[model samples]
Target: MEWEAPALVLSATPYGEGSAIVHVLTGEYGLYHGLARGGSSRRGRPVWQTGNLVRARWSARLSEQLGGMTAETVHASGARLLDHPLPLAMLASLCALADGSLPEREPHPAIFQGLTSLLARISLDPQWAVDAAMPEIVRWELLLLSELGFGLDLGQCALGGGQDDLAWVSPRTGRAVSDARAGEWRARLLPLPAFVLHPEQTGTPGDWYDGLCLSGHFLRRDAFGQRHRPLPEARIRLADRIARLADVVPPDEATGENSPQPD
Candidate 1:
């Protein structure tokens, strides 16, 4: 079988001496692993880096086999992000997360679009790259959680039947809670940062940080499992670098009480 599609290079691992096994997120095919004939060489190296956009053709004897890909560069966005450390780390984390979590060869059209959108956004707004990416990444995780059948109810309090003024999410049930309803159980709940519950209301570095904590906690605990697979170091480093630029607390604090205050 043979097919061609728009693909974003998520990862490339050396296969033998000169060849590489390329993992791409395709609009139609989702995450696919294909062998690139000479992907390790200078000419192919640029095209195979994570975040490179390419038009790829794949062929194999059977549809299920590890196919061969002939890729042509459509854009080289990844190389541009290298100059900025924080954006680069964010990019690295994104690639790592997608590579680890996404099901192979299954189409995730929404995620593919979101990834492309993020790449484009980061390329243009280097100063706000991390800030810009946090929400979308959280959204993507929420989508992934939903697709995995562990969707959280973020709209309102799951138990109180009232709007979640200060949502304290239940880690066990993946639901939002109001402060009133969480009276006795307050200590048991995770603070739902306003940026996530209401991004428009919270508009600071801290808000973005809160969104990450909220989403990351659920993703690791519920989606990934308690083995405590830390987020790629690059991600944390990037968030730190960006926080410095914004004159804010560390990335962890950015997600806390001081996220961009609502205008």
Candidate 2:
């Protein structure tokens, strides 16, 4: 079987002497792994770097075999962000999360499109850093969890069905909990930021962190937990960086002059 698709480089690891095993996320093919000859060589190195966009063609004798791929670079995102640590880290975290979490060969057009949008935003201004990058990243994480079948119901309170005064999220059911209903159990519930339920609203750094924590809980318990793997270090680093920045940037200003335009 043979197929071709536009793909984003998620990871590439040396396979043997000159070949490498590459994992790419495609609009139609989801996440795929293929062997690439000369992928580790200097001439082919840039084509396989994480976050680069590529036109990939894969061929195999049988339908179920691990195929061989030939790719040509379309956009060199990794190279462009090399000097920008925060955006670069965000890109790396996105790639790693997609590689580790998504199922192979299943189409996820929304997630793929969201990733490209986030990368384009980062590429437009590498210096935007954590302040500019974290909001989109947090939204993307929530989208990913939804695509992976653990979507949080944040529209209204899970128990009361009331939309106003929603305050906490049930870690067990992945649903919103209104403050009135969360009286005693609030201590056990995760904080539900207003922006999460109403994406149109601007959110503070604290809101962003709360959103991440709310999503991280399910990502760990539902996604990675089932796989018995921890969340990637790159993701953890991004979260820590955002948390630290939240301490410095006042809540009101975080979504104002400091934040990047919403993705």
Candidate 3:
């Protein structure tokens, strides 16, 4: 089997000598791993870096076999964001989440679009990018969960309190829970940020942290847990970054405790 298409470089792990096991995401071809000769060499290193937009071609003798791949850089996102730590970190987290969660060889076009959209936003001026991209990255994860068949129902309270003022999410069911319905069970539920329920509004740093904590819970439980894997380190780091910005302790990846900000 063989194909050539526009691809996003999700990750490139160094293999024997100069070769790399390159993983890429395409709108039509979910996630794909292939062998790229010289991928780690000095001259070839940048092409396979995470978050790059590339024109890639892959070929193999069979549909399931590891293929030989080659790529040409279309946009050097990794290099472009080298001096911008926040955006670079966001890109890394985004790439890592997609790499870890997506099923290979299946198309997830919406997730692909979400990724590219977030990448585009990450290229803006540093502070603007950080502010804007934080919510976007959270939303992107929400999109990923949906694509992975674990979509959160943020429409109305799981307790049937209706959609108004939906303020918490049940970690187990991935459903919204209004403050009134939360009752004594509130502390056990994840926060459902107002901005997440109303995307037109801007999320304060606190809300972004809540959004990450909310989405990360399901991503860990449903997407990675079923496969017996933990959430990606890059994702944890992203949450940590957002927590620091929000003046809050990062949520524990295992416990999903939404730690309150310092008083």
Candidate number with greatest lDDT: 3
**Residue-level lDDT for 182 in candidate 1:** 86
- Deviating ranges (above 4 Å) for candidate 3: 253-263
In each prediction, how many residue pairs overlap at the backbone (N, C-alpha, C within less than 3 A)?
10, 0, 0
Candidate 2 lDDT trough over 10 residues, lowest sum: 252-261
Write down the lDDT that model 2 would get: 0.80
TM-scores vs. true structure, each candidate: 0.84, 0.89, 0.94
Q: Compared with the true structure, what per-residue lDDT tens digits does model 1 show for residues 1-263?
A: 98899998989998898899999998898888899989998788998988888999999999999999889988887788878876777778677767766789888887788788888677678777755666666666677667656678877787867774856877667689988888877766666766665545535666555566566656565555433455555555545654565566663322222222211
Superior by lDDT: candidate 1 or candidate 3: 3
lDDT per residue for candidate 2 within 1-263, as digits (tens), equals 99999999999999899899999999988888999999999888999999988999999998788899999998889898887887888898889889999999999999999998788778767866444566677788889999998888888888889898999978777788889999878777878877766667657877777766776777766677688877777777666666775674322112211221111
Which sequence of candidate numbers ranks them by lDDT, best first?
A: 3, 2, 1
Q: Candidates' lDDT values, in order?
A: 0.72, 0.80, 0.84
Error of 3 at 126 (Å): 3.1
